[model samples]
Target: MSETTTAESAERRVRRRQSRRELIVLAAVEVFREMGLEKATLEAVGERVGLSKASLYYYVRSKEELLGHVVVHVVRAQEEALARVLDAGGPEERLRAFCHSHVRIICTDPVGRVSAQVALSGIRDDVVRRPLHEYMSRLESILRDGVAAGVFRDMDLRIAQHSIIATLNAVPLWFSPEGRLSLDEVAAQVSGLLVDGMLAKR
Candidate 1:
């Protein structure tokens, strides 16, 4: 084959490999969510995806690695989504968008919800802490900006940031698609509750 054709063929192979890995991660997320990260086993994940335990290692080094992929995927998505909203609006608007996005990610999206549900305690600290800290910092920055803009009341910024994050992070634990409130309604309600409280009174 010509060099160009060879490169194209190699690229296709890489894409196919990545697609398979993603499929494995999705199956692993379901198992982790149902069984709890500490209780989940590679064999269970392998069975979910129709791979033998040995075959599963071709895609992931271990159960911890698979969990790492799952969490990182969701975290990266949240980061990207937040990045888009950060520059698009003033602090209030950005905070609203952030709240909505958090709910949508952790409640509306199944994989994202599963990712959120997985306890970070089972994963390595470095694997879990960096992205989480970054996300927390992003939230803090928005709150700081809002306060500086005179749109938000002066309060304990750290407490406000943690409260907002904890509330949204708990969505995957109790939120139900079959519940009376649609995801959009939950998102709006959450945004209102958190954002309205912080608004400076006239």
Candidate 2:
């Protein structure tokens, strides 16, 4: 086959692989959320996805791999949110956009939130842990950049990142569409506090 055809074929194969992976991950998310990490059974996920337990093993090597996939998916979503912030206008705008995007993802995707909490402890593989830690590091980098730019107040980036993420991560626990505050409203409140705390003192 020609080089162009080969490249196209490769791209198609990648898409197919990604699609199958997504399906498995989605099913795993439901299973994990319902059962929690320690109790989640591969057989349950197989049933959810309409596959026999043995058949599901073809896609996922073990329950641990499924846990990894779910956590990795959440990490990827946060990374995408950070990329969106990079395209935003100024420090304030970027911070607000990041908060909004982050909160929306966490609250709306409960399964993702649960996966983020449970997967780290449950996975014994460095292959999974390293990437998750790196993705988390990106959040601190954003805060540090804002501080250096004089838009955000000088504070320990580690504490700030942890405090902010911990608060936002809890959104999945109590957030409700019918509740008093909308997602955007909660995000704005969080952004206000973070920005105000980080603003240069007059």
Leading candidate by lDDT: 1
Expressed as tens digits, the lDDT of each residue in 148-167 for candidate 1 is: 99999998998998789778
Q: For model 2, state the Cα shift of residue 29 in Å.
A: 1.0
Candidate 2 regions exceeding 4 Å error are 1-14, 79-85, 119-128
> What is the clash count for each candidate, in the order shown?
0, 1
Q: How much lDDT does candidate 2 score?
A: 0.75
- How many angstroms is residue 138 displaced in model 1 relative to the true structure, after the best TM-score fit? 3.1
- In model 2, where is the ten-residue run with the lowest total lDDT? 114-123
Pairs that collide in candidate 1 are none
Q: After superposition, how far is residue 50 of candidate 1 from its true place, in Å?
A: 2.8
Candidate 1: where is the Cα deviation over 4 Å? 76-88, 119-124, 154-158, 176-180
Q: Candidate 2: give the clashing pairs.
A: 153-198
**CA lDDT for candidate 1:** 0.81
lDDT of 2 at 41: 91
